[model samples]
Target chain A: MPDTPFIDDGSNVPLSELRWPDDDLTRIPDWIYTSDEVFQRERERIFFGESWCFVALEAEIPEPGSFKRSYVGDVPVIVTRDEDGDIHVFENRCAHRGAEFCRALRGKAENFTCPYHQWMYDLKGKLMAVPFRRGDHGEGGMPKDFKLEDHNPKSLNVTTRHGVVFASFSESVESLEEYLGPENLEQFDVVFKGRKLKILGFYKNRLQGNWKLYHENLKDPYHATLLHVYLATFRLMVAGQKSAMICDESGRHSTMASAKDDNIEIGEETASQMKSAFREGMELNDPDFLNYVQEFDSPWTVTMQIIWPNLVVQRELNTLGIRHIVPRGPHALDMYWTMFGYEDDTPELERQRMKQGNLMGPSGYLGVDDNEAIKYLQDGFKHSHSQEGIVKLEPEKEGSTETLISEASVRALYRHYRQVMDI
Target chain B: MASTHPAGTNLSPEEARALRFEIEEFNTEYARILDEQDIDFWPDFFTADGFYRVTAKENHDEGLPVGLVWCDGRPMMQDRAAAVKTTMVHAPRYLRHYNSNVRVTGVDTDGTIHSESNYLVIETLMEQESRIFQAGLYIDQFVREDGVLRLKARDCIYDSLLIPNDMVYPV
Candidate 1:
């Protein structure tokens, strides 16, 4: 038999190999996490190919001329609002030699001038001036053929909903509403609630693993009550909690809604009986730290909403934020998390949110635990080169299930991945 | 880390030499404890009501209040130590913190010493070469109690915007 190449850059790896074994959405191959070819295909077909990717919150560029540079996959783009108070997104590349036009993380400017060649562009990405367009003297001017109108930077179809900005490179992509679907749209609204978002600050980190691993980590809900001892020990979540894994019809987005097993009296009794996660007689050193006042009409104590391609709007017990993903390559990616709240929030509420924020970020009490687990997950795939792995936890039906111990949401992500990549 | 009577960031020749030696020794000891992973004694380095926070310089410059790790008192710091010791699971790594350029900026009349120093933490994972993990300025406020120096506040403002993997221990 021909020696099967266990390790490949994914060029020679056949498209047939991309298909899940036995056509099972629950089965994921290791190669998907390791293939550069797969990453490029995803960039082309998923990111640049007909998807509304989250760029910036409307609040980030609230004023006219205010702009923030963001990424859709690996392609950097500028999100700016013009003097007309309309949001627009375009490639940050300069028209002349493709250097980045907007270099700052954020700033306000009447227009942008590329440092490389002094190619000036209006706030809306219209080419306005060129350094040598008219030349030193009229005698050296061009043949009167270089039209500035023809050389404007490439722009995208952009929209702002509930102070969240989304841009799509493909004009043919569905409206942001249709793309998010009704389920995700409802959850998004629940988080945004028409309140103006405030850019509190950002927590950024680079994970030395596949970008999908983060998604997989969120979709894999079973690991939560096991790994994050803080959650289980506090009865914030447990296997017996009344939870649900909600996947959209498109299978591209998902929301995990978990109501604190509310029966904590009984939950704690059961937990105290358990040996590993729930130890007995543990109390918060500062009970004030758990001073959460539910501001939402929703019942879920913790809601992690995953928008297709790149956005995660999170509400972890009054701590609200968005997690944005940028794929560095197949093996690594960056996560920029912006923690925020409403502008009119009370001082006490803001303090509560800030204190509660400790449960998240690269060093969060609960968040760091997931990183370690995902690192372990990536380590497993780096060596195991398995053709297909099992995910059939509560796999009776795939879209949404009323259980926390299910990998159906992860399967939902891959289902959309297969359709978009045409595997 | 603390310093005694490094008044107004100026001193006589003898006092300057003595203060420099004291502050340098204080920093060296602080770094050594963390590097040696004597986490139990970590909180004792701080005053009873001291504050500790680790935030990115980006956030600090923007005046953002959130931190990767924010502890309000020695109790909270000790709780963090306990959590890191018993609860957290981290891959085996050796961490060594280097503190340099200790500058005592000012001294309050109440014996609170204000100092700043540059720090670099080198981490070596099992079977991996050591890498510069974090480089930042230790913006500190120190106070003395019963002639013993203790940290009043430590703001570890990390300049590197991107945190690698996860943070298992305090900076």
Candidate 2:
């Protein structure tokens, strides 16, 4: 017999090779979702170990002294704009010990001072100050020379393009744009719009679910039509539109997009039933669904741009925003949603964008449902089951695809996840 | 003063009474429309150039600034409603808006009335099982036109810092 992999039990592969199920080859073991051990391994192997993650947008820290506290994987990081306006990302923990240096979410700061001791460092991660260096007595004093340069927080490599900022722990990782791939890059530019932006606002919510669930939510386009019925009922998106769930080459990034179509009329009964079921009133003013209709040089009415690891850019009709998922633990996540409009947006157009903004966020009809659904998904995984959950809704194709509905992109996400995690 | 009408909204005692009645009726109708998931009726609550904002207290005060949802003009609001009803999908649920402490604020030179009110909304879903989905407050500002009260701007300030789940409907 050929030398085969053996089980932990002393039993040889000949006895039981763990017969793989052909019918459900795409399914992942349910233990991954519910096991603490798996989550811990994932943190070490994927998050802390390697992989490029989106930490912040270049637009967030435009000024030279501006800085925004963000996270990569589970590690806290500080992305700052130096005097030259170059962006830099550094671990938020102090080098002396593991104390968090920056507590504020965002602000302009010249130097980062450690709260524990008076150790200070400039924005460039260069040590600037150290208190009580020339001590009083010989016993209390340090040796002939003490260098502050030896104690600066470690930093990850950062890259910014078209106003988006990305970082990576792995030196061998490809260029940020290359890692993003074309499909995701196109979706990203849809809202980043290749211009300066004015930060409209930020919304943060503590969700009681796994962070991966949120990523899966964006990759799975089938849920959009059903999860955000408010979008359909209001005639913003229709089944007749040419929509698609696209993924990057590495299957790490995804874009769920669709065009606006008003020609597809619904039956009176169905329309009325839909309208009645969601009661948010379909008729606000007139049926000017095409109100903010400046043609975007793109294919879809909206793009839920899923950047691998953390960021989700929602390029909705006229409004654009980024939803950053910061995981606190296996069962908790903090969703930081930042809404934005261009600096050149006319007051009227800005008003319209703000109005449409109501359709998302924590209170928005569509967003609330997504929050609730993901929670339920995690809740379901609490129980053990013989059958694993399936994201294999469309296994017939690979890469970019067509169809108003399909969870193929989500399956692609899992494929990449398994690859990265070496599962 | 906490009356049936909002404060600073220039409504005479008698006018306040009538306006209060109309406002109460409007709130009830609005809730019914949402409870029934009537997306078509959603836009009708605002004026042609009205504003609708659902923002968090943290964002509003700290200037962290982001709206849960925002609609500047009625057209955008209408589009949202149409989209949600026609294209969006989620588990069905019933939304109940319980509005109280309505006080009329200052009335603008134009018939626009600045009003503020404290309201509580609770949502329950029917999945063959009943579940409390969300509960929050509606902080609103309105205007009266030709004996009709129209919501000029309604900002939903949810007391709970963390949302229970996804809020599928506007407050």
TM-score of candidate 2 to 2 decimals:
0.76
Instruction: Candidate 1: give its CA RMSD in angstroms.
Output: 4.0
For candidate 2, write residues A1-423 as lDDT tens digits: 211123121111131233224434367554555456556766776666556777887778888989998888778999999999888889998877788889987889998898898788788877787777777664565456777777678878888777878887777778876878877777777677656887887777877578888887877766665556666656666555678878898777888888777665765654554444333444544444346556478867788888777888887888778888777666668887778878887777766667567667776657767777776776566532324676666678655678755666666777677666655
DockQ of 1: 0.51
Categorize the docking of model 1. Answer: medium
Alpha carbon lDDT of residue A419, candidate 2?
66
Clashing pairs for predicted structure model 1, backbone only: none
Could you give the C-alpha RMSD of every candidate to the true structure, in order shown? 4.0, 8.0
> Residues B71-133, candidate 1, lDDT per residue (tens digit)?
888877877787677666567778999999887777778778878889999988774567788
Which RMSD does model 2 reach against the true structure?
A: 8.0
